[model samples]
Target: GDVCVNTLKQDWSPTHGIRHILMVIRCLLIEPFPESALNEEASRLLMEDFEEYARRAKLMTSIHAASASSASKKKATPLSVDVANHLVASSPKSSKKEK
Candidate 1:
């Protein structure tokens, strides 16, 4: 749930690279906070029901974890953090204000 939404905008040096960037992206993907989302719900499916939201989030995490593990075993195009974020954002749903 550690989202570095403004990491690049902060006072940091170039010691960080693509991996770091991807990590932050991945964090957002895994724990998207639509209610407090910087993108204003554009990057997540804000469900009205808390239980349903939790269920969907868990499913997504499991899917991503599985894909990441499989990708880690291979040498070709390993799953980067960015890829994870894309999956979260691309989830098939719409915005619903949390109750």
Candidate 2:
């Protein structure tokens, strides 16, 4: 995924490459491929039916924004639970090591 982002930054050096890259990125954002995916499912959805894909993308974006806002409200300060757990588990053990 990071490599793909880097690839997008590079010059396409070919006609219509920019357009194709944009299409692919759009697909990746909505329907990410964590595994080895030849092409993203979102792109196929878009190519098959643009209208439906756009509608769903818009809805998802709105829902994501709302959830982000909700989460932001719940977080009031620093020192997360993960940090506390790490500090507790990472202490030295007072035990002799056996060879």
Candidate 3:
């Protein structure tokens, strides 16, 4: 079950706080509900070949982890003041006059 679509949106309640939400997410990860799966192919693979599914999941996790580490190492350069000002000035909202 999807956290956003199933839990947060559909099964959302005042009683279900952050802790409850987290627990639900944890449960889903531990034991996935294939019936309401967003990715049918993954669900099918998981159902058909558990070993293959596990292997692919591990591979994807490692790939993502490597990319994430590399991304963290690269610092984002801040936009120059001149470019920021130009962007603001060029916006459609900036062109509109309020009478």
Candidate 4:
């Protein structure tokens, strides 16, 4: 994960807002970070056989897209303030120490 998205990284800063975080996520989706991949097999496939990896990723995207479209058609519920606050609080903080 990128520093902006991974709060545990020393490079991470509390100053980064949602816009910056989303941009980093979009960049990651466009070009994955295989070096820090949680799925070793997928990462190895991506590095060793890019064509096959792309084919599989496309297939999975289409499959999930169809499901997501149907799910989105249903009424969405707004996040409660408590849940939102909890999520913000639970997020990891940067490990950097200030002098």
Question: For residues 15-83, could you state the per-residue lDDT of candidate 2 as single tens digits?
Answer: 434446666688876666534344466557667777887898799788666676687788443322232
How much is 23 displaced in model 2, in angstroms? Answer: 16
lDDT of 1: 0.58
Q: Which candidate is the best by TM-score?
A: 3
Best by lDDT: 3
> For residues 1-99, could you state the per-residue lDDT of candidate 3 as single tens digits?
244347767777876655566678889888888777788878898999989888998998886665766878996644322332331224555546878
Tens-digit per-residue lDDT, 1-99, candidate 4: 223336436658776655565667888778888887777777898999999888988998886665866888997544322322332322233333557
Steric overlap count per candidate? 0, 0, 0, 0
Estimate TM-scores for all models.
Answer: 0.34, 0.31, 0.58, 0.56
TM-score of 2: 0.31
Candidate 1 lDDT at 57 equals 62
User: Which residue runs of candidate 4 sit more than 4 Å off their true CA positions?
Assistant: 1-8, 76-99
How many pairs in model 1 have backbone atoms within 3 A of each other, for residues 3 or more apart or on separate chains, i.e. clashes? 0
> What local distance difference test score does each model get?
0.58, 0.55, 0.69, 0.65
